[model samples]
Target: MQPMALWKRVLILLVCLWGIAAAMPNLFYAKVEAHNDAVAAIEAAGGTATAEQEAARAEWPDFLPSALVNLGLDLRGGAHLLAEVQVEDVYKSRLDALWPEVRDAMRDLRDQVGAVRRAPSPDGILRVTISNPDGMTAALEAVRALGSSVVTLTGVGQSTLEVTAEGNDIVVQLSEAEKQATDDRTIQQSLEIIRRRVDEVGTREPTIQRQGEDRVLIQVPGIGSASELKALIGTTAKLTFNAVVSRTNDAGADPGPRNLILPSMNEDGVYYIVEATPVVSGEELVDAQPAFDQNNRPAVNFRFDTTGARKFGDYTAANIGAPFAIVLDNEVISAPVIQSHIPGGSGIITGSFSVEESTQLAVLLRAGALPAEMRFLEERTIGPELGADSIDAGRIAALVAMGAVGLFMIASYGLYGTFAVIALMVNMALIFGIMSAIGGTLTLPGIGGIVLTIGMAVDANVLVFERIREELRSQKNPFRAVEIGYERAMSAIVDANVTTMISAATLFILGAGPVRGFAVTLGIGVVTSVFTALLVTRAIIEIWFRISRPKSIVV
Candidate 1:
């Protein structure tokens, strides 16, 4: 309205554009070189890389930031996994950490409750068969006395009280708040551990988010097989060091065969036993790389931190002839004997490893260690065929919608409609540039939302242009009319966009996956459209009025 503020508006717009570009590099332009490198690596692996990857490799320029807006598996035709961690493993970890107290508590509960009954279910959830439910309350008090923490006490059958761990695997009595705290912690820790594992596998852009309590949603765009992914993440990566039972110690031992340390077991009874306590755990290892053994076989070479190296050297020197097992997720990969003491704190793990298997083992060993053992729950695969169809349909739908909206605006508003069309183009450019800068995935649903946003963006300009016509009818000059129209229509435009933005925000917070993606494009469109219409379009109109300086304002 104030002479279109050309220089000021352009400067502000540039600043906004630059900021978006800095924050997100995915939407506006694709980075070519890194994309090409990814293609080359995959091709070198004898895998079928995508056409886009080939194009990127051939044409990608240098100097783009490493970050890219990665498409979701639904759009890119990749792998999806839903993993549920073993709550029992979580409980066991806690119990093992607090063994002295937990063992004592369970023993005290058994003795105090007396007459313990087995749960009807096959899962072996034990219950106390009390003479009176009220009498069992005293025994519960004794269990609570083992620790001051709250305990959960549930009545199963008439005289049975079901006592179990409140979180993951460890059952303990806790208040509502404590239960919530435990749930929060497990989810948080699991997310971190999963992130570390997934990163090790070298996915382009993987997403690992917590779903409802106790479940995690993992999406890897370029990954093909769900089973391989499940194998990669289902491991809890729990490593323990235990003293080995010697042959002499097994004979009439006071501590019953010197404390038989059982290895971790899979559902099918597959288990591994570490013959000796690990002088240094996987946590101490800083890096792992695939290498070749003396026989040119695939092997994983690992290096430990200073402390780990020192401990390893000391332990190997002390136990020169004994065998130490290389265990993973409770299964032994290999158990090589300490032929001679090596003090470097670096060693190679040689096994029956293929090239891929060697790489995977190196990844796992390098990903630090998992807090607890995990298990696979569910998985799904979306083929490239479906993804291609979605892209084509989405593109056709967007073109049709934009063409229809453009025709309607020009038909209704005549000459003024032409200006509204120009504003629409600017609005679109800004949206795309912003999206590219942010690197958000452009899904089919996201495209639908953007089309809807374009219509809403045009609505604001239409309202202002119509208001200007009304002012001209009231015998005002074109300049005066444009100013008044902008002033009069500003409130309505603000109210409309604000309400829509609030709704979009609400959807974003509550929705999951695709729904959230839809909300994201919708919300971004609203803010950018508002800026283009209220400032950019207004400036263009006012500047035209100043130059023309027409006597009679055409309606």
Candidate 2:
């Protein structure tokens, strides 16, 4: 056989060496992980590493690729929560907000509509009664004018609100298109907020995804329990600044029209009557951090965005000595009197909170509030012991498969079979290297993929070796037989691997979770196996033949 090109051989060698280097860090996972963490800590602190951290960093060389394949939740253990967003709650808030607008609009045409009064209605519905029943058509037209087009791709040209007149009552509710849009926004915002919350705790690769229209699925690896995960994300954190009109200890106090009575967070049973319209919403907050109050108590310091800052500065300037309620999730956190004209839109919130609670509140503020409340429908905690057992089982299965394959290959075709076995090992290394490079997660099914790949890795080699035996029978020349064998078997090897790769790709696109993990390993294995079988084994055989200069080769 003709020798391989020098550049081609060098390229192949370099690739193999790179794969080996990339895969090396997994052998010392804990040490490499510590080095990476130390580097991150030093960068975050803007300072030098400690002596222990320095030692840890030195355990892994900086020049080589140090990425390791992330382990999946099934392998690492974690908390899982399936939550459903209360999207209808947003509708109620939306209608409540619209009351002021509707009332103002009706007031403008008081002569035509007569007296306008807000009538109690179910959630998501707004009912306004007019004294004159004959003028309901004109009133409906005026209210309908308030309906704006829904701002969504599927809701283009559709009104955000529906207006109808029943006798003297004008009924208002969100349009179907608007409801769909709101649901979409709620789920997306919930997912993002959950992600931010989980990421704040420095958990690795926590999965927070929208399950359906109103449901979210959260899986946080390394969390102690589902309850812990819930505690982190369950709070609505709906912080708002409302102007306080009166203070009361009565739970059933009447705050009059367009006002609400909310219970205090620190003082039990004490409530405050505040305006429904917020001066600044939590959505306007740009940043928040855990801080200490002047009294040395834990607190959360927050800064608002430009618009919010201007609005807050103007409001405080106009209402000095007036109390404004800091509300969170319908509860009054505090009703502090504005002592002076506060500017710059930065403030500290002090309540009866512990250090941990303050820190969590700060995290929530930074992440922003969930659009609406979420009800956790399902919760689960997977123990680390179960994950460890799964890892052990998968590891044992893979090792046993590798050993059996290696032994079978060696017994079947002698030195040539040993070459195939070596190529198989290289194939495994390349698979892991690629996975590590891409930050792929390894699930239990992924280990099964690797084991299956071990058995299949040598199929191309076996085909070539069998063809070589046939050629040897006909030609009786080792060099010519090897060349002809590889050439003739190339088409079959390519066809087999390509078909399998297509299957793996389909699995990846159509599957989720463990199936996706299986697809990833399988797809990677197919590519690496083909490379090792065609290049590595051939290189080994050609080199052996060149050194031995055999006249005839054994089958």
Provide the overall lDDT of each model, using Cα atoms, as 2-decimal numbers: 0.66, 0.89
RMSD of 2: 3.4
Clashing residue pairs, backbone N/CA/C < 3 A, model 2? none
* Count of backbone collisions in candidate 1: 23
Estimate the TM-score for candidate 1.
0.70
Give per-model TM-scores.
0.70, 0.87
Candidate with maximal lDDT: 2
- Worst ten-residue run, lDDT, model 2? 204-213
Off by over 4 Å in 1: 12-56, 63-69, 96-184, 199-213, 240-322, 334-358, 366-377, 546-549, 553-555
Report the CA-based lDDT of candidate 1 relative to the real structure: 0.66
lDDT of 2 by residue, 1-555 (tens): 888898878888888888888888888887898888888878766777799888888888888788988888899899999998999999998998898899998888888899999998999999999998878888898899999999998889999989998888999999999999888888888889888999898786676777767888898877899999999999889899999999998998899987999999999879999998999999999999998999999999999999999999999999999999999999999999999887999999999999889989999999999888999999999998999899889989988998988898889888898999889888888988999999888888999999989977988989999999999889658888888888899899999999999999999888877788899999999999889988888888888987999887785
